[model samples]
Target: MNWPAEAAAGCSCAAAVAASFGAPAFRLLSAGLALLLAVAVIPVCAVAVRAENWRANVYNEGLPSHLVAVDKNRQTFLFFEKKSPLKLKYSFPCVTGQLAGDKQELNDLRTPEGIYFVEYKIASGLDFREYGGIAYTLNYPNPVDRLRGKTGHGIWIHSKGFGLVPTRGCVAIGLKEIDMVGPRLTPGTAVVLAERLDESKVPQPDNGTARELRRLMHAWSNAWAARSRKMFDYYDPDSYSKATESFAAFRQNKERLFKSLAFIKIYNREIHALEGPGYWVTWAEQFYTASNLSTEGVRRLYWQRGQDKKFRIVGMEWTPRDVGMRADFQKGRLVAAALPPPATDASAEAPLPPRLDMPEAPGETAASGIPAVPAAVAQAEKLLAVSNPLVPRRAPAPPPAEINWGGRPGMETDREETPPAAKMPSAPETPPVLPEPAPPATPQAPEAPEESMAPEALSLTPETRAALEQAVQGWNTAFAARSLADMAALYDRERYNRLPGVPRGQSYNSVQRDLERRFRAPWLTLISRAPSLELQGTLAVSRCEQLVVAPDGAEQGVRTLWWQREADGNFRIVGSQFKPEELGLAAHYLEDVSNAVSADLEAWRKAWEGGRLDDYMSFYAPDAVQQGRWGAKNIRRQKESLWARTRPTLVQLSGLRLLMDKRGIRADMNQVYADSTGHSDRGTKTLMLRFDGRNWRIQREDWVAQTPQPVGGSPAAPHQNTQRAMP
Candidate 1:
């Protein structure tokens, strides 16, 4: 046997083999050694396989399918791919905040350590040196960070343009590394940021912490669906305040919603738990339906162990987009139908599992401490309640504090994605059997809270008050100028139709016409004074004494206008009501007004028959359009000329009727007229009347001939027929 020179120089083992025995003995010993080495390696490989399986089954199964883990201390970026086994797919060097510890305020230069998600991507408008070419925006000040009173925004994961320099409260990696992982960092991708990566902290499949969190999640959801006041108790007041406008405001808004919604149903599925450095997060696909809306999304709740060692929800986040929860629920139902029934005899069954009646968190405890929630009771409470009684969304009343009814700038609370309006599906006649004890009765409008107990209504800022006054002044200016275009610009046309005293069918166009007639007088003067304003949410109410002076006389009254804060942050007149009693107009019932209108119609007929031109003209409004004539003046002139040409003999009216319409009181009647010229005609006449504070006058008059009626010579000429036919 020959040993290679390199093996002889490098292998003491080769020399030892040669020295230990002769060639034949060495061969036999080598065979025995090989067998022993193979036997040892087999067990080692088996242990490694079991370890991998343990990790997959215990940790990965309890986490989201894909995860982006960033270790600030280690300056490492990790990506767990979306695979059935959820294995780490990539690891790369990264850059974190320049300073140590979590971010606490704006410009803190410290990265936040918590669970967040990629909110969006910034593809353009990049400051190359600062943010690199491409960046994925992370929801920093995530609910947990917000609750902890940590501030700072614009946190992102981006490629590093200036080498691997530390970022200002952000995570940065090499351009090549980012490009490789960019596709997986889409919106709603879970991102776990920690000070250090510690395997010990990873959650196990059925650990105590995970089980307790599940129980808490179930209870919280049940309380919400039940509309129980206990739902609010799950939140840590001190921490929750930092995340919302105020605890009181939050409670008030939620209470209002609970009362307004006839029923609420919340179903959570595919729940997963993740343990961060100090907090634990449980997230799941949530399907929520209320009387007003239905939304499917992912919801995450951050829980922290308090000083008393009890876990409580510090904050929460919701991503409102369909997550197939409904479809999955249907599939689950089908699968459940195929399952075998449970054993009938209780004694024959195995021992029952331990209950999850854990202690509740502090600050929400009753005199009896934490309430017990045994497994049996929890199972009984899991069924959904199905009732959908829609509550009408009213136009917001004027409010002192600015409100975000939908989406307003600077709204404090983060709102889920809600459509402007959702069409509600009719509820099924029979709902699934509810939990043993029924939920609260059908929603009732809660009584207003006592003043002392009511949440403090935020007072409007001076700027808002000034803006409202400016809007009112602008409207007054437009009114005095008689500029219809400018007035239209200041009014929300849709809501403007609801103005008081404005007849139903009358639009802003008619209002403009009426104003034109009012301002027709030469040397007219208008004054508005003593304005008082009140606010309720986006709506503002302004009342002022208004005076109108004309050639004939002066009219004074109080004008009330409702203004709403539009999406553009400007105020516009929505509706207005005038108090005519201030101008000494008598208030009368509908019947009395109808009778008065009838009396006026009769007197007008008499005036025309007696050829009293002045009295006849008096019955028409100053700018009334009569018999296709433009004004009362033109109508009077035409009537006078026609009467002079042929004297009136007789006039009769029958089948008279009066009805109220959008315009005003409208009178319909059959009229018979004959002149000294020995001509007669019969027709149906219509008079559209308007009331000018004191009396009703004809705003419009029309006549339709009932064919030729030969009471005398060759029926009356078409052009000079009935009372209104004096063209």
Candidate 2:
């Protein structure tokens, strides 16, 4: 790929967008990968504000924090919060020495460092190959990393991934950290990691690193502060100044954003180095409108020094640092921070499995020649259109990191197809009682130093065997449901396992607490289909497809997952993946657009509600694609799509699962879309939605019509609507 040209195109697109609003020139500098290059075209004219939707928030408050790293050399690192007089120690299960690295490739593991915080948290299968729970990636390798001549790769964290052992070079940690920090860490949290952890390396809150990050905040704030398009340093040269057409658009938008807030300010900030040279600093944008309406989730950020040497922010993420800020400006306080999309590791020539836990590469196809999809698979490809979010997906996080499950049968970790979000049919005549199966005859966690597991004893009596079998099945089903009650009922309550991917001091129980809290609410919905269950004695795997939705109509699909029957006879999700749709381009676009909208989810929502369709459409490429039952086409297809959804159908939407990226949004709707006659479908539809540089629209779909067919359709009477029957 032409990196320079792509970079230039991004710079121009961003500059042009900023110019469109008659705002100062904002240019996209060298940072991130082609994925980052793909979103320069998102329009900033019509801001859509969706306040009801929730964002995962991460922050820092002079707390004790440290970064740990493990490399191919079997070397590990723990960088503590040096500024704090208190130096605390953290211990974690280790999994180092994956790749057979040469001296020249010391930095190939691609660990990163920057002022970043955890965007979101989820039990990502990619994080743990052996025992997996949660995983979080550091917002690393900021633009500065590239400019500083640091070019390993990013997404440095510790987890037992979904595949076999191999990392260019990175550190591994427990699942506990991912859950504890991923969601709480927001944009602007400092994430810095180096080979050394001495006091000298401590970033004194006012160090140059801090200044660069604050400069970013100042730039964005100033950008918002100004209405004239000049008085800025960034932006493409040719389109440096706004032409007449662009000037008009900029003035309209600039006026509203600048004048609307009754009160606004930076709420909170944090700093950290997630890995090597990758630092991040997050700032919360808090506001209270004069009308008594208020917002606390928006987070503005600057990712300085990615792979780039200068401090150019790759993008801003959504966060909730100011959540506590009250709606009443008269008496306000902070709540929680907003959450941003999960981040993805910038990949290069290094070989990686589809999931982090899987040991073997599916097949070593050259990364340069990654294959494209064929026409028959267009439906599947559309599902793939969702971007790879920065946080653990709404449900399934990243794939489990590769682990050595000790070449055992019945013990193999399953691939992540989707989260078990769909409701299963009530027991259908209770299937025949099957005999107990063996536990794949092998352990599935190789990288886990073996201490987590105790000595095993085989049990073999017909009655005892049957009892164990039934118990395992029951537990499996509960996990499949992902129900708060069912999950809580099965919690060990004691002797919990630290799985992998979380921060050092956090507890796994906190993850359970968060999941329970989230599941208790109706804001997020899972969008998975029926699960196909398997048994390998005490070990079991469930492969399923699902849709996860947010309060608004946003959705994401989940794929494969594996779970084990705990000693308490309850089931817990052990490993999982975020790519249940397997649709090409979905992961790519999800990350790009989610990153875009997350920075301003509420703004985008308001624009949509106000019917700023043209301005709304600017968030995507002019050449954007689309696919759905209404059929597929270019930008024009929206006409048909809008007519179909808004037409007199009775789809009752409870919560929408949204997966996003820099380009736009992907949503899984748990729609009870009623028939014009009023029957509800209670299932889900997978929509590959996106912004085409103007408005949020569908670029593709793998939507199963799960909408139920009403009773008594005429054999051949004049058709009312010809949509497929609900599954």
Candidate 3:
């Protein structure tokens, strides 16, 4: 109590003394008061410093050497590289998902906070501006997330438009930032996201679990190299669920490959193990060779401890290395530091089985007069027989009385009853030529040699049909195998032609190049079904439904191939046509025009909602017509006024239909608009766009309003005065 009272008394005395004194006396009193304040503040500052919190500076000590740390609280992405003095290489402002908080369930719309890695870089030209200029994919819902029961996919790090808007559970930065950093980030680069990042801490890999995991991986590799089927015991066959084939099927397939190849070798490097919830993930570079073929790629294995206290592979994924990564590895710029030693157990050190000998010629026989087929070859044949049935040679069945054209063949029909076949009109009977037959029997008149019957139309024999089917199947298999040379061999290079929407003159060379480019992707597959073939002389036409699955997406369409039989009795594709089942286009002109118009409309909506005034107006032609209450003359001014007073939050277009002619293309669609003030409107929108040999521009736009109706109501009348036209 004495300190507080003494301070108060001294302040009051000093104030009174200063007021009552002259200028010289006041200056002396002020100096004395300043000295007194400094004396009082020193003790208080020392006490505050002693009690201050120091917990924020205690950073995690396990951060990796080279990594990206994202601080959600600060909205910054800091790039760190381990050097003599650890320092941030760069700092970039970043945006997260729409919702703030850690992601949990599917569609939570919240960014996840954890350590992850760049899965891969998306190819250019597949995404829209909404995804910024390009994107780098992230392995969201990774093993850890999945173990925690999280779901959803397609989370990425991308760029945004002009503004740093929210995302759908993805991290986004500016376009410039992506361009500057995209190339530097590669697969396996670490990305750590936290509410706050502490630069003082460095993360280190969990070496204990990593060592155990590496031992398990080496044992598995040793077993493979030794061609030991006992390796299957190491895999938790019952626990594994990600593979497309069952354990038995996988074992059978592997056994076949092992027997077929002369030798198998495996080299592993860049091994990394990440600890997840109740499991561990090990990823590494794998170089494999069988016979004369060699391939290098990245392989990931998810390992989980079983009841027996042994770690077993629960999941696996393999992907070919990216071109850039492969180049770097070849140049020794991205080589691994070191790989763990191979397994030393007696079983793992066992020698590989010898390759099977080729079967002898058909006429060659053993001493016992039986065909000289190796036992291994005989066993492989038996396995193949069980797995794949041989194409049987049999007589072709008669064509159906009436072919069903209502739906695609090989697809189930929803109709309750099958339609009856059309009845063929009875062939008219001709009167018997009895007298002519008797005259012909008189043999004195040498009978004219019977005219050879012309080959019947659509009469393909079973052998020929089987050959055609094999050709088509071969094409499909080649595509699935991603063999560009095999695919090119099936195509008629001399007379290759494609229908509209595809590039013209797609010769064998061009096709091969295209296939090669496509094969570069991590996922590419083509499947065909319900093939119908028609033969005419040496030419054949086959139609089938083709489903193409790629990294970007999947498309199912109808494809027609024209094949010409060569002198060597091989059928080759000469021409082909493909039409997407989603869009029912009447002609080629409408496909591109329709797509362009739809894209333009979407861009306009995006621009308007983003508040980009100049971009919103750029879609319109200079002389575009607009009709409203103020007529067409003040259309721009009216829009400007509306934009100034209100902001558009959402615009959705549905039921879009297009009609194109020589002049332009017309689009009719239903529109729904919502604004920041909670006002909403639904109406029909029509836009007319004209193409000037280069670009398509909006010539006219009309918006018609429909009165809101009660639920289950029949119809609503349009408001006559609500029509607004825009350029």
Give all candidate RMSDs, comma-separated.
Answer: 32.0, 29.3, 28.7
Higher-TM-score candidate of 1 and 2: 1
The Cα error of candidate 1 at residue 548, in Å, is 30
Model 2 residue 91 lDDT?
Answer: 33
Q: In order, what lDDT does every prediction score?
A: 0.55, 0.34, 0.51
Cα lDDT of model 2 by residue, 620-683, tens digit: 3444432222333343355435535543343233223344322234444333344334443333
Query: What would the per-residue lDDT of candidate 3 be over residues 425-474, giving only the tens digit for each residue?
Result: 11112212211111111112111114423222233566666677777777
**Top TM-score model:** 1
- Measured with C-alpha atoms, the lDDT of residue 617 in candidate 3 is 75
Tens-place lDDT per residue, model 1, 292-330, is 434455677878877877787776765444354434433
Q: Put the candidates in lDDT order, highest first.
A: 1, 3, 2
Please provide the root mean square deviation of candidate 1 (C-alpha atoms, Å). 32.0
Candidates in order, TM-scores: namely 0.41, 0.32, 0.37
Per-residue error (Å), model 3, residue 532: 31
Clashes of 2: 223
